[model samples]
Target chain A: MLEEAGLAPNVERKMRLDRLQRQPEVVGEILKEHVERQQQTEGLTLRKLSPGVKAMIWFLRLYVVFMTVVVVVNVVQTVHP
Target chain B: MAVQDVGRENAARALDRTRVDNARKNRKKIWLLWLLIGPGILVMLGENDAPSMLSYSATGSQFGIGFFLPFVLLTFAMAYIAQEITVRLGAVSKTGHAELIYRRFGRFWGNFAMLDLLFTNLLTLVTEFVGVVAGAGYFGIPAGWAVFGAIVLIGVSYTFRRYWTWERVVMILSLSNLVFIPIAIMAHPSWGAIGHSLITFGPLPGGWNSNTIIIMLSDIGATITPWMLFFQQGAVSDKGLSIKDLTHGRIDTALGAFLAAVAAMACIIATAPLYIHHMNASQFGTAQFAQALVPYVGHVGGALFALGILEAGLVAATAIATSSAYAYGEVRRQAHSLNRNFKEAKSFYAVLFAALVVTGGIVAIPHFPLEYVVLIVNVIAVLTMPPAIGFLLLLINDKEVVGEYRNTWFLNVLGIGVGVFVSLAGLLYAMTIIFPNWQL
Candidate 1:
């Protein structure tokens, strides 16, 4: 996956593991899921996501939804009014 | 196990070959810099799109060569601060901005990022074509022919099927943005005043009003935008930058920033005559500005200004469309590199061409609020920028992602300063729009 992304594979391996260890707070939450998935032979891909990520993404969607609605109404009122 | 061993052997062999090639290439320092120059220069010049030039023109006509002369320069500096981080992030991750955000942050967040990019890219792409059509209109070119020619010209870059070739072609097209410098020179401004306004931030003929704030934010939007973050990072990854290329990356960004700043300032200086003549700000479009300038800078200079706007639109359309294509490919885990042939990256190329065609068509529609879109696009771009910056700072500071290449303390201060500036400006813009009578 790293090579396909055009990253030097060996260097990527070291970089990923190093980052995982240094940022332990996030490691268990994000990296460990990838590790276990890899161990299960699922192959390394972008499909995997943790619960925390899922929650954050939903929050963003809701936020954009609200902002879009407000901006649309405001623009219409201003333009057409 | 055998496959791992074979892969390692192949990689090692490739690495040795690369080292030899690098040694040979490094012998010509200037040539090496040229090769590393694409992404930064492209993003910076690309940001100087049609609406941006108009905003700069409006700045000149409204405020003259006063406060905005220096302010534009400062905004570009902030742009460099923000974009420099993208260079490091892309080089370190070997992944586009969307992919890295999705990988580290997850799918749901990726969806939001994708949405923001798609929404803004589409809007910005439309304005670019609007510029193209309007600028070409100056030469009596029909909108259909101009849009068609623009799509074709932009498509030529994609046909090269390699990032290097595409970068070189786009860089050549982008360099035409320099035409404004000659137009500025043609205007024959007071050199002392130009230097004085730049250093003193000059007086605001109409001081600190809502319109002033709007123009300031618009100018800021033109300089350091959200598309810039996505496009530059994607280009760096597409160009296959590694951490070792960091210095070249910084130089590429700084050089681009300087050129873009100069081009923006030139537009303002060239149009300062409109302010001196006291033309209404509402009356200044590409054609109007060019027509008004004929009496001042002569016919050739006005024609060149129109051509510069055309080039800006053409260059920015290509870059903005690619940003959308990059986001699409990254989120879906498809083949996304410019190195891939059409058949190999069908979805990638399709998305890119589709964006150009759709946006280009939209700009061709009569009385389609192209003016309204142009007016609102840059400001809205600034409005949607904070989240992009938030994601950027997170990824760049991701120790595992950029590793040792993450921003240092000084860089962090600068990056956050840019973020704060954008957020504050966005807030003020929002408040002004909402209230419509708030004093700044």
Candidate 2:
């Protein structure tokens, strides 16, 4: 679980165990919350985007390409002319 | 605890402890706000970069204080709309923008976004050094020393190895960007005319043409760009803001927008004297603008203007370099926190300083056509923003990511509106370039 949270397990285990001995319920609650947050961070997957969303993304991609060409042409004309 | 965990946890715990104490004691919210107001303010002022101030200066010198006063304000509003989403995304998901994009969109599309960001950021960073060099030239400082000084000053802030310390030190330096405000006051602009211009949005002296479209696009780019989204989200996540801090986060972003808008407008007002004198300053460089303003604003004000440009460039270079580092670290799954020491995050520091060194070196090359880079850097930023905004909107609306903190309907409308406006502005710029004779 500590590894999944991107934490060093060996280091975390000793510290968490020390805290658990002093405050069992509090430590358990903190551990549960931390694990949940870690799951949220790691569980993200590629979203199944809608068709309209997909088209919009494609349009924006092509728009960038078109603009890049325009900018290059503009630069060439201004610099050379 | 492990050393890495200790360093990260200690800084974050300091703030988290304060927050808990404030709630428990029923203390004033103002103290809590002061703690949460770094990223938003940093991103906003950082965007008021050297080229951006020069763009605003160009607006005033050419068009006087007419249409652009309000137009600049609107762009910040658009910036606010787009940036606010990042705050929520960071606070809720605790993931940086680059990582979120790669996770949800897959690496194929993510690389494209990264390419666009890095390309625009590199060009913009070069212009920043150009500003630093030009500003230093006003005081007869050599370009080599100026670039070296900027790199060292930026590097010094990182030595603290704490996000809060870096943010506070840079925030103090970024406030120097407001030096334009006093310079504007010294320019003695007509208050009545300024009021009338804001109300009417006109007397746009030359009317709409290719030059006007370029400036408008540049102005939009100045406020809202891809780097801002990445930087702010990374800062928020690294600062360890949670969903409970969302209200403070929004306040932080709004305050940033307000302060940046004021500085941007002050820049235009400070340079309007050139227009009043009928001086053609359309081709003036950063130092040239300062020198030309001396007759109207006097020697001290001119110095202030030059210093403002220098601060703008320096503050922005720090932020932009860190943003690139953040993005790189996020994608590589490496230690990326400012809270982490240099040894713990070697690649992060290397990327940050490497970007600064390379861009600064480019500006030091004699007669490298730095002006052209300054002129088009903002334009290129705007052109590349639509796709960045698209990805941003996608992630913000992804229920799996932001969960219950997803954008509201009204927020989505505003977000989409900003995207459409940016796209249309880019399209108009292309139209002007394609058909030089075209006029609006």
Candidate 3:
């Protein structure tokens, strides 16, 4: 199914079964160690964006709201004042 | 020496494992998220570019933020809702919006949609060029020079027959819209008044004047257009998103909406300095407005504001022009992917190039009354949204097409509500334009 979606097929079962039934005990142990290492490497790690970039995004949002109000006030003053 | 060599060997083995592990992780990430996210995010952000930003600026200048700022964001939220449905429909059906319309609703309605998209898109393209010229004119660049330079840049970007490369180039250009945020900061506005407007939402601040109504409607129209629907869905399919990536697609849409809304808000704020100081130049050209901004925002900030306008125009013209090409490609059953070479999707590329050339060329003409072009582009975009929303809701609910991924009841309720709101907005705008003082 994954292959049809242009993805790799999850062949973990095949790999595991090959180790369990076809490979010798010592080879199976080595294969298990390799698979365990692979899984460990594939885990997600969270990294933060640079502080400067974060500050910039925050400043941008606040500016939008502030400027919007000032323009509205200006429009009001123009019409009524 | 022995201990050091052993340590190096162990480190090398660890490095090899880490590399293989990283590849596997990346592969999973690509499959799970990357493919689905690209097209939707690109389309939404691209839609927010040039013309939309300018429209928001006009909204602020003419009406201020009162009814329109909240209203613009609300309309954009509706746009996101509508676009979210398209994301699902595209991923599930693996078909273009135009293709689905033809297959299910037959050719007449489909042809009607095609006509509307092409006409509005071409007109909007002209306005985009007007914006480009206006922005370029700020720093003393001639209109002809700016238009020609933009056209050349667009041509080069489209030369590569790969969707990924095209998406990346457009994304990079679109990011320039963020320049508005800084300009807004430089304006030094009053936060208390802004918060007050948000709370009260009353007296309209500007009142129900003709100009206010027109600007409000135009801002809404700019934020949510019929072309956006066709563009995002076509882009999704062209980019080859599947069901597995649907969640990522939704995230991409949400993020795009947030960014686009921010850009829109930034534009309004950036221009607020002029609008607030009673500096109503009532200018038709973006260059004039941008040029006027220099005195308020300082030379550097003014330059950035002008650049924002230019980026908005270039990015939107590319997307709007591409929407036309996509619709034509779908209807004609031609190869439509940006992945295909120009010769492969000859009619598709030709239509895209033709729209850009004609529209950009028109704006280059001296004294073109481009304001009228802007008015028409926005008005037509508003007028066409209801039908597009209706069709979108219809297609997404069809079991034959969407299967199990069809919209839930909550989505349908909201979608219908959006349709009605857009319809009324369109009608009100039409009435306002046709009979400017009818309410009085």
Each model's lDDT:
0.78, 0.87, 0.68
Writing each residue's lDDT as its tens digit, candidate 1 over A1-81 gives 223333342343244322323333333232232233223322224444458645654554554465455456556865898
Q: What tens digits encode model 3's per-residue C-alpha lDDT throughout B148-198?
A: 998888888888666666887887788787788888778876666556555
Ranking by DockQ: 2, 1, 3
Q: Pairs clashing in candidate 1?
A: A19-B400
Each candidate's fnat, listed in order, reads 0.01, 0.35, 0.00
Interface RMSD of 2: 7.7
All candidates: CA RMSD (Å): 8.2, 5.0, 14.9
Query: What digit string (tens of lDDT, one per residue) describes model 1 on residues B1-440?
Result: 11121122123222322332354355757756765678999999999999899899888888888899999999999999989998987766656788788877777677778878888889989999989888999999999999999998888778866677788899988999999999999999889999899788887886877788879888998997778988998898777565557799999999999999999999999999888888886656788888888998999998999999999999999999898888889888887767677887899999999999999999888889777788878877776776777778767876666667787888888887887788788667667667777886
Residues forming the 10-long window of minimal summed lDDT in candidate 3 chain A: A38-47
> How many clashes in candidate 1?
1
**Residues B247-321, candidate 2, lDDT per residue (tens digit)?**
889999999999999999999999999999999998999999999999999999999999999999999999999
Chain A only TM-scores, each candidate in turn: 0.40, 0.55, 0.39
- Ten contiguous residues with the weakest lDDT in model 1 chain B: B1-10
